[model samples]
Target: MTESLTIVRDDLTGAATRGLIAAHLAGMLANTPVESVHALDLTELQHPSVRVYSAWVGGEIAAVGAFKTFDTDRAELKSMRVADAFLGRGWGRAMLGHLEREARDAGIRSLWLETGSGPDFVAARRLYESAGFSYCPPFGDYSLDPLSVFMTRDLDPASESAGR
Candidate 1:
């Protein structure tokens, strides 16, 4: 498909954008216990380390994703979701590419993420794996937990030999 989507920093002041994100998250966690999901709410998105992006297709919000820095050299992938209507239309992949670009721009050397091991998160885990993220020990405030699976991908552009 032609790349007709635009991904840019989210406009938190826009009610529609915020609503879309909240709806997506709510749908994603509808069946799981709140404690099992690690996604942040609107208030947490305002943190200094978090950079949120929204994807627009035909001027309508189609997807959203964020990168939250855990340290100078590391960041966590968070809140990645594409509206149901936009699924299989490449929005998720585009948003992911944008997050990686943002990570690189911020000089982040590694990207970490935590997703559930349940059926609800199967697609998410596959996406991360396809994007080159591999299983890793928990990082940041997270600890090893049977309910969670952590993954990480290193971004060392200077190391040309490193696989993308």
Candidate 2:
């Protein structure tokens, strides 16, 4: 099953991809306050600084993930979601790994992310933690928010703790 999962850069023009992003945003809004919802919408994901990717299993979109590059060596993970029909099959972790590799190859030395702090985000937080992300202060234009959890990880290949 894993071999069939092909992840590719998305142009954000497909109906399935757009629908999945919408669902991701809706889920974020439903689980967290509007002010704390940081999931990028379709237009935002298409920004020049942002790169979106979609994982396809067979003909259906299994998951979507993206990152927004900051200054030179930093990027923020955004819009990560596994389709409801594809959850619990390790697709989320696969997508996370895919994004990490893409960022690293693009010269990104640090990967940051913000997710909800409520129960709804436990799995997401855990997935990040297991992938070497550690809790950190908010980065970029973000600030401290009780409903948000900020995390970051070094992507430098020479760093001993790149993924630990």
Candidate 3:
């Protein structure tokens, strides 16, 4: 907990970033059915609508989180993973909060995410809920499935009221 951490927007095409993403994808797939694994890969992360980030401590990657735009008012959290050694130390929470702030500043009023709904994902589910994300219908191209859980949170109270 004493190590300094830096989470910033990153390009995922780099070798190290690719390695981190591969590890993340492995975890996601291993924890859920292949059809339900919606985690993005290197090619998918290159889309113009997506922004990737990496958290660093002691000059090594600590975690990675991504922001994917859904039109102008909505964004989806993608590729959220903390290095195994960094788990349970609040890096994931910090990265999620950072991405939420980035999305809000970019004018995204709604933030959504899709994660596995299995015991392996308990910690991730807890992190999202504790950060104010709540269960919601499947988003984007996703459909309801017992293996997947979708959650969302309104980023701006003012916008939520304005829409009403």
| lDDT (10s digit) by residue, model 1, range 58-124 | 8788888999998788899998988877888877877887788778878988889998888878888
Candidate 1 TM-score over all chains jointly? 0.91
Candidates sorted on lDDT, descending: 2, 3, 1
In order, candidate lDDTs are 0.83, 0.90, 0.86
> Which is superior by lDDT, 1 or 3?
3
Give the lowest summed-lDDT range of ten residues in model 2.
155-164
lDDT of 3 by residue, 1-164 (tens): 68899887897756767889999999877777788889998989989999999999977899999989989999999999998888888888888878877888889988999888888889999988887789999888999899999999888734322111
Model 2, residue 31: C-alpha shift (Å): 1.0
- The candidate that wins on lDDT is 2
TM-scores of the candidates are 0.91, 0.94, 0.92
Model 1 error, position 67 (Å): 0.6
Clashing pairs in 1: none
Residue 147 C-alpha lDDT in model 1? 77
In model 3, the number of clashes is: 0
**Top model by TM-score, which number?**
2
